[model samples]
Target: MPWILVFLFCLFCAPAQAVTIPGVTTGASASQEKAPPPEPDVEQKKAAYRALADVLENDTSRQELIEQLRKVADTPPKEQVPVITPPEVEDQKTVLENITDVGRHYGEALSSRFAQLYRNLIGSPHKAFNPQTFSNAASHFLILAASVFTLYWLLRLCAWPLYLKMGRWGRKKNREKSSWLHLPLMISAAFVIDLLLLALTLFVGQVLIETLHAGSKTIAFQQGLFLNAFALIEFFKALLRLIFCPRVPDLRPFTIQDESAKYWAVRLSILSGLIGYGLMVAVPIISNQVNVQIGALANVLIMICITVWALYLIFHNKRAITESLLHLADRSLTFFSLFIRAFALVWHWLASAYFIVLCFFSLFDPGNSLKFMMGATFRSLAIIGIAAFVSGLLSRWLSKTITLSPHVQRNYPELQKRVNGWISVSLKVARILTVCVAIMLLLNAWGLFDFWNWLHNGAGEKTVDVLIRIALILFFSAIGWTLLASLIENRLVSDVHGRPLPSARARTLLTLCRNALAVIISTITIMILLSEIGVNIAPLLAGAGALGLAISFGSQTLVKDIITGVFIQFENGMNTGDLVTIGPLTGTVERMSIRSVGVRQDTGAYHIIPWSSITTFANFVRGIGSVVANYDVDRHEDAEKAKQALRAAVEELMEMEDIRGLVIGEPSFAGIVGLTNTAFTLRVSFTTQPLKQWTVRFALDSMVKKHFDLADVRAPVQTYQLLPAPASGTPPTPEEPTL
Candidate 1:
């Protein structure tokens, strides 16, 4: 099998030199002669031709042997389309011949064209100059100039003061607050300045060209020069704005030193102007006046110089790049952040590679190279610009929608943080979608891929179906989850206003159910999506079932707790806020879970008692409770008077509003329930609502003390005394005393 695989690889993957012409080395010296080719072996040549034929016919051989070959002769590959005449069409000269005719006697042609231009310049200087045209152009230029200056002065004088005032207001309203409004104002000012400058510069060029009243060639040259110069100046302005972002150090995103920023900006600006001038201004004019070979050579050399200068500038500012990216990467130090940092480095390298490739094309295939490069460059830039604009609009719209959503802000006030987080994620998805669409459009524009063709194709149809299924699943799942959550929350809120405020147990159960439903919906959606995308989910479901069974067995205690809790709830053994005693722990029932119950004690401490550990359950606050107090009275006191005093106290306690509502019946003074050595016990009892027994008992005790004191009924007390010898006989002790 291994030998067959190797044979197959060798048969299908032939090198270019083995089956076709070897590529010519680019930029070789003119004086260097081409190397003579070696003669090919007859058998090897036959095998090579056979391989080429097999490839062209799309034929495969599973058991073909690799053949040894002699050194082969080299030649240029045949052009698929004729460079000169149309294939199989008319009899016509080649493109090279046409160009030759055009460039015939190049020096004489240039001299004659120059002579004609000079004669025109001399014979009709006044007409060429056109004083009236010059005056009109000058007037327009002056108007544009004045407008530019006025706008500039307005910004410097009025806008600056307004910006400062706004900044102060922001500070006063909320110190250290970063106002979103301020940023837009600052950005708009910079943008206006840049726009006015671009307009003024372009207008000046138009005026100069109109005043010259030059021929088409001169006009083109002037326009190209102006564009190049304007680009360089704009770049410089952008750099300056970036360095002075917010025009306030406090608001600057980056912390680079002014000196470093200024130094790099100067060097970069100089390089930008030099390269832009060479490519846009010098090259076009030189190419117009020069032969094809010289023009190509000059472009190649100039591009090389520009590429080298750009590289130098890039490497020299590596410190600045690193500093800026380090600050960005500091925002997040996760794997994605590291990836972004690495991608930044790779992006710079790719940019350098792009320039290097341009130079290579100019060197070897300069014809229409610039035109093709510009076309692709502009298309790519358009895609980027459009994606950015659309994504920004989408993000802003999403932000606004989230902010204005009554359900999001009102229904789940606690979910404010989550709403903001999801908004950010949604915006990111929107940006990603924009980028994808822009990429497809860009590819279509470049003739690289036809989106409509793909859309109509069989594979594309399948893909679309899968995507639709996924989208539907997500939409329905989200709707179901939201509806379930909202219903649960609303029910909870409604339950709060009932006789007893909504208990944590009810809320907990609803929340758990909602979460469980969400998980179930998400799982089902994922499985369906996977199936739609051609992934089998049957095995996954089987594995999950097995795993769950194994977990159940391993966690028997958990199962026991869940079962016990279910029975407890079904039997209504306890309720949230009920004063329940479970085994040794006693407190108000705070919350109930499938496996455990949370009890909050009077001391504000919580005890989480697992159901498995609860062997006894006592609930004191479930219904009415007896408030019983046993009072000991002195035996010497009249039982009737005590009884009367107790009755009076109970009556007084009943008169109080708080006790009146709590007591189910009048407090009864049951006479002489018990006898002790020191006193007789009287029982007083009353019934009150659950959890109100303590309050009633306290009030009753206070009332009894007051009524007894007023009635002169003595409370039983133990007394100790010391005497002289029992008074040694009673009589004389009165004088000796009270010893």
Candidate 2:
């Protein structure tokens, strides 16, 4: 048998090569490049044949060998033809051509796959509805269901006391008055309890399957599927319970009515159970037990039902939900209120889009659709909830007014006001940042962005660095302003002894310095911030310089005003609260700026006089003022007596309580400076404090009149008496009056 196999192998192996026999020659070798040797003649062929015949004659299995030889002779030989090389293309395909080719191939593959699915669907029902298969599947499903139901009930019974406790805690009243942590803690406890029950049920079910049903693959598969479906559906129901908490109105985080909460909880649980079980357990089980096409058809039907149901619920409750959201937004005083209102307006559309997207995902990629949707939904809700909570706390804290201690307020009153304003702006920035971060997290969770990778990338690192620098800049800027303002205020405020109140001129200069410092700090901060944000500030600086040049050239009057005002301020010309006269307007200097001074006139009209417009300026409160009084007496009367009366009046003025301090010097009398036909004039002058000249003059005049009257010093009077009009203007007569 071994010899026969070896002989057959040799005969069949490499048929393209010529077979070699002893002393026999074939011309097959001549085809090679190597030249052939001389060929064997007819005598050599006959000798080789004779020797093979003798070997066969000497064999014990002669007949078998002859038959094998005949068979080998009948077998046809394989012929070898000359090798040929195919031609190569001279030009390569373009990118567009390659893409087109790829698209065509992809389309073809898709069409073929779809065609196969259609054919399978057409024949799947016939194959799937076998009574035996149904009996087996039904038996497995029933056993699995009974086991899961028993396990679930047992777990629930064990956890019933805990559930009751959670319910009571959730229903507790006045929870809002409790710590802010109460709601989160209660919700977490309820979720944990629900999750514990689910885990216990699944764990017990798994142990039972491994112990009793380990030998049966069908039973194990069915039980595992049932447990997975239960866990998934129950997990979703747990989230729903966390949100709605139907039995515990106080624990419902959202401002939803009890009835509405209950309605939504029940309906949502039903929906979740249907989708989760139908997709995760039912479709998989059917696909495994029956046909994939039947399973796909079931998946499509279930998704359609879910989509229609969801749309029905959304549309049915659209108006009520929108109104509820609007009311909530109105009640809410947080930064998210506007977002909530906007969401309310478009919530129905978003819901519709969600369902449509789910349907498409299920239709196209049924295997991972449920997992992707559930994960994305949970992550989105969690991100938004956490963001809202944090942002709310921030806004609440920032909304409060910062009260400084009495010492700080006394020293720096404006600091508290500035701090509050800064906090308000910070709140807005924090809210915006929170929203942006939430969006990024959601996108990352949904596979729309690779946030982790981006965070580690160069651009993201630089961005974070820039933000940090900007925040530091802003913080230091605020601190610098506060310290500077506090210092300025400390200098301006009077001490306990009231000895060092800043003069008006000093106050004005300090105010201008403060303003200039603020401008410089602001400009420098902005420039640095712009640079940090990757903006080229050189161009901005150049632009600013050009703008300044243009302003200087175009507004010569403004330039003149500023220059003149600067000189005036440096020269201590005037200050705020100084009684000054400029041009035609004279009043108290109410306010002063770099280019203009606001003065209120005695008549109650305010004038803003630019420094360039001020041609003449007078300051009444600069130095000492003088009061001069003139008194007249009859020339016939005793001049000595009149002078003595005036001297007595001056003595009386000095003895008065109000006028004594204002008088800077003793009164000086210039006797008989002028003589008139009716009277002679006596002048008395006294120096007083600045701006007290008018008061002193009035008091001195009253004293002089009283003295003149007491001394019988009356001024002469000239009177004219007209005759009777000269009988209708025929002649006019001039008359002199008697004194």
Candidate 3:
């Protein structure tokens, strides 16, 4: 009674203490929240927990609580139990349990039936390995082996002769055409013979197995054997084709030495066949009752092994293969054919690289790796193949459309043989499109198409968008630039007369406009593009402004030149075709840009001079000019007669139409303006058309000399006058000539 009472006391106390515990609130509140809550203290918390522990620690009470707990635990749920588990879980559990029990029963019963049958068949368990059973199996095995061997040899004998004869015929035809036709024929013949032999062997093995009434396991083994045998035979046939070339040297596909081919073929064929046979045999074993992951790994390993072996074979004999590959291309192939041959040469190495990648994926991710690899491989091939095909078609179409057959063959013989005006443009455009498509396709195939979406939303989007904007800007800018250039060229052409000479002012204007436009366009495009690309253009602009200010101060001469050149063009100070003399230099104005001019001298030297350097210049071809000739004559000769003779000489120049047209007036002699002891001077002048002053001067001089002789006009003679007053100091000796 005391124990029961203590147990009740502890339980009641626990609930009461819990309700009144500090730092712990109960579900029901005291009336009117009785008193305001007090601050919690560590000492009070300890006291409360200790008090509860003390009551619970009493052995009698603890034992009673334990008993109660045991009773509660042992008590079953109500007769109509409520579901504690989820409905789906309960159903799954029940179904799994029933299936497990049924499977166990069925398996046990089947095993027992099989064991009983085996015992009955043997008449006793001890007779399972009897001599009679062994003898029966041995007889069946011998029959199967004999039948396969007989069929193989019989087919080989008949097929070998016929295959050899046909190979000879094909080789003869191939040699005449120098083609690969015989090579395929040889491969097919060898393969067919071996294939037929393998089929016959399988047929015989199947018959023997059926006749012997072999069990399922025995039949399975037979089937695996036949399959593996078939694989081995095919492998052998491939190797054999690589070797003998079927008694026809011309039919050999590889460039290997005869002896080497035979030797390696024999050894490699045996090894390849054995490995292939083992892989095929292991396939069935791995598929049944094996962990799928392990099976997948095993299959990958076998495939990798085969790939590695093939690579080794090809690499080891690559020299021979290369020779054979190139030989097949021959000299008869066209440009396109040669391109294909080149592609094939590179394809060997590409294939090796591709296989290595496949192997790497297979190692880390056995599942889905193959699918990814195949997809990637096919995607690459498709992109490259399509791009090449499209590019080729574009080139061909352009060539056909732009043919030079009419123009180049007749008038413009120096022009390109094919139409090429749009060819280059089309090719460039095609290349850009192909690259864009290829990149997109590659991204899609690699499952990275989402990357583009992310880029659009991410910070990278701005960069890409900026780049796109820049591209558009550049494209339009280029069009504008080209149009401006075309306009300048047209202006230049129009300005040029029939003599291929343009006016200096027109040429200067066109050149300066073109150059200035280029600079302005480039600067604007770059600034806008930079701003779009997230560059702080404000600072760039500020810096550029500062730099330009500094440049303006530092290179004042450059600014001066530019200003002067602009004014010069507007003032028509000089023209491109003008025969101008700038300071000391004389040349034709070849071309003029914003700040400078290109002057090509008659000596074949070129000069680039700033406009500032030409502060003063003479443009002889601007308008009419004058030629003056000063002739000295004897004081005794009549000045009037000499002047008349000079005029008469110039009159003779009118006989030539070219000189006559350039002459604005007849040549006339001016009165002597100076007299000296030596002679008096007479000046002759002619007003002629621009650029013809020198020509008239030369002709007039020649005519004057002839007229002077005809008129007997004397030339000027230098004389000395002797002074008598100075003779007293020193008489001039005969050697002291007079002055």
Of the candidates shown, which would achieve the greatest lDDT relative to the real structure?
2
Q: What TM-score fits each model?
A: 0.57, 0.78, 0.55
Instruction: Give the higher-lDDT candidate: 1 or 2.
Output: 2
True-structure lDDT of candidate 3: 0.65
lDDT of 3 by residue, 556-664 (tens): 9999998998888899888777788887788888877778888878898889999998878888888798888888778888878987886787778778788898889
Candidate 1 lDDT over 1-739, as tens digits, reads 9998985564334332234221211222223335423435666656655644553343222112111122122233452311111112234699998888778877676677556534433452231334564354444434544553455445445545554554455444444455556544554555465556556656665565555534445444445454544555554555455455434333233466666656656766666565555555555544444333344446657878878977776777676676677667777434336645875666667667767766654544444455465567667777876776786576566556345456454545434554555566656666676777787877776567886788779776777787777767766776676667666766566332253435555666666687778788888888888888888999999999999999999999999999998788766788777898877777888778889999998899999999998888888876688887998899889989998999899889989997899888776667789987778988988989888899999998999999999999998878555554454546743433331
- Of 1 and 3, the candidate ahead on TM-score is 1
Off by over 4 Å in 2: 1-137, 153-187, 212-214, 248-251, 497-499, 716-739
- Global lDDT of each candidate: 0.63, 0.79, 0.65
**Stretch of 10 with least lDDT, candidate 1:** 62-71
Relative to the true structure, candidate 2 has a C-alpha RMSD (angstroms) of 22.7
Tens digit of per-residue lDDT, candidate 2, span 501-562: 88888899889989998999999999999999989999999999999999999999999999
What's model 2's lDDT at 258?
89
Task: Show the lowest summed lDDT stretch of 10 residues, model 3.
Answer: 81-90
